[model samples]
Target: MNDSGAVLPWLVIRQDDNGNRYRVGRYATRAEAQKMADSLDARGHKQLYWVERIGQSVQ
Candidate 1:
C-alpha cells in the first residue's frame, strides 16, 4: 500500500540539527498520523511529518 494522502491533509514535524530529518506518511486523520509518527520512537534527529499533496507527483 502506498499510504499516500488522497485528500491532501497534513501535519508537519520538524527537528533542529543541520536540517536533515523528516518523514512523510499518509493518514486518514491528523491524530492517526501523529500517533504513527510518535510510534516511531524518534531520537537524535528523526522527525516525522504528515504532509499531504501540496503540489503534484509524476509517479
Candidate 2:
C-alpha cells in the first residue's frame, strides 16, 4: 500500500514451463511491475513473465 492506504494495483506474474502460475510481487504502478517482469525475462529461462492489474484489492 502507498500513502493513499490502498492496495497496490500492479502485479508481476510468472508462468513456468509446466504451466504453473505464481505471483511474483505487487507494485504501486504498472511500470514498476512491468520492469520487474522484464528483468526476470532477461534471465533467458523457459518461464514466462508479465504484469497485470489486480482484479480485486485486499480489504
TM-score of each: 0.41, 0.81
Q: How many residue pairs clash in each candidate?
A: 1, 0
Cα-based lDDT for every prediction: 0.49, 0.87
Q: Candidate 2, residues 1-59: lDDT per residue as tens digits?
A: 76779778899988888888899998989989999999999999989898888895322
Q: What is residue 31's positional error in candidate 1, in angstroms?
A: 1.1
- Candidate 1's C-alpha runs over 4 A off are 1-5, 11-16, 42-59
Instruction: Name the best candidate (by TM-score).
Output: 2
Q: Scored by Cα lDDT, where does model 2 land?
A: 0.87
Best by lDDT: 2
